[model samples]
Target: MDNKEYIASGILELYVAGSLSEKENEEVSALIQENPELLAEVISIEKAIVQLTAAAKKDATYSFNDIKNQLKDTETKVITFPKPNRKQYIGWAAAFILGSTLLLSVLQNNSLKEQLSAEKQQLEEQINKSSNSLADAEKLIEVFRDKDIISIPLAGQTVSPTSYAKVYWDKKTNSIYLDAKGLPEPPEGKVYQVWSLTLDPLTPTSLGVLDTFTADVNKIFTISNANQSEAFGITLEPAGGSLSPNLEQLYTLGAVAS
Candidate 1:
């Protein structure tokens, strides 16, 4: 029989209880010797039984040594007499009580194991979340420390007096990291659009719409801009970005440093 199947058959409980026949006992001992897991299972079962037995009898202490001694002893024989004494009846009653207690202990042990396993899984999930958060913080720190990056602060405009944002432009990569944490969440059916402006002709180029406005945790967006941008502006537009920014709906604007 498969070792797992044998272990799960409740045979280990009987072996620990010293209820198995001599031949069956030898077979289990050989299996336990070969498989460390099986040996561990047997030891756990034995310990639970001993604890249950000891708890059942307040005055008695049941140790592994006592259990081993009992296992080595020959099977008990029932001898018939003309009259059975009260001692024999009391002994039989005690055996039934101990058996019931052992069953309950086994059930409680299984429940505790299940609870421990669930807690272990929850701990692992928390560890993974913490690791991801740390990685994101490290990456953001690197972006701030880069030598080729320039910070441009965008102040609130007439449309939204409290709104503000920042743009970190990386000259070497021609990429801009838009930090819009201070901006209010967009309204229904409306999105925030970013623009790269040229002051000479007052031209505006649509960088892109902030599609994941509400879901983005960092509120930081990356957009490629190779233009000779003199200023940057943000406006509230329709679902998809507008061809040209609406001057009336412009929320924030900042001019590039000369």
Candidate 2:
């Protein structure tokens, strides 16, 4: 099945929930590695599950500590009875009530503890995401500051008048860091493909496809480009990309400076 059909099959949700069999899990894992869009979908499903779990935990109505304190503050009254049988019956009733209260208190406390633990886990995850984002920003700043990096600005083309993107090419490393933050998300079953162009012959070579555009938080992707490219262009194509550039779908283009 195609990536779009596979993603819409609801199997990713089951995979995230750990309901799939081991063999199925392995198959999904292999597919995720081969397809960026599938991996993105899986990650999205997992994040949704985490958010729902956190919300349910937050909605817990009772506080275990508060209930415990209230029980402790309650005053107990004792009365002397003229009949021994009546006194004995009252004592038994009191014991039964006390037992039920303690049992309930224990159960509630356990539930509260579980909720508290879940909240803590969610907090940790948020902190980690923040830290990772900060690290990425710092790394990008360093790349931009490098003296050897070539910055190329790709302007919008006829197909997309408002879309724009930038390329940071590191010739020393034979790689390019594409900043596509200004481009719109590709429609389902479509992806943006990058091309390395040699203007002398006007030949185009495929660099790679951005299949994870919808899932990428920063819209920046790293692709290997060892070609002696004189220009760069981005075109929207069907998922998995096209063998050759489709000029009709060209969204952005920029030429390298001498």
Query: Which candidate has the highest TM-score of all?
Result: 2
Native-to-model Cα distance after best TM-score fit, residue 83 in candidate 1, in Å? 23
* Model 1 agreement with the true structure over 125-238: per-residue lDDT tens digits: 999999998998897778888987888999999989999999999888999999999999999999999999999889999999998989999998888989889999999999
**Model 1 per-residue lDDT at 229:** 90
Q: Among these predicted structures, which one has the highest lDDT?
A: 2
Window of ten residues with lowest summed lDDT in model 2:
76-85
RMSD of each: 22.1, 20.9
User: How many pairs of residues in model 2 come into backbone collision?
Assistant: 0
Residue by residue across 68-90, what tens digits does model 2's lDDT show?
Answer: 74575456545433454666787
Q: How far is candidate 2 from the true structure (C-alpha RMSD, Å)?
A: 20.9
For all candidates in order, the CA lDDT equals: 0.90, 0.92
lDDT, residue 124, candidate 2: 100
- What is the alpha-carbon lDDT for the whole of candidate 1? 0.90
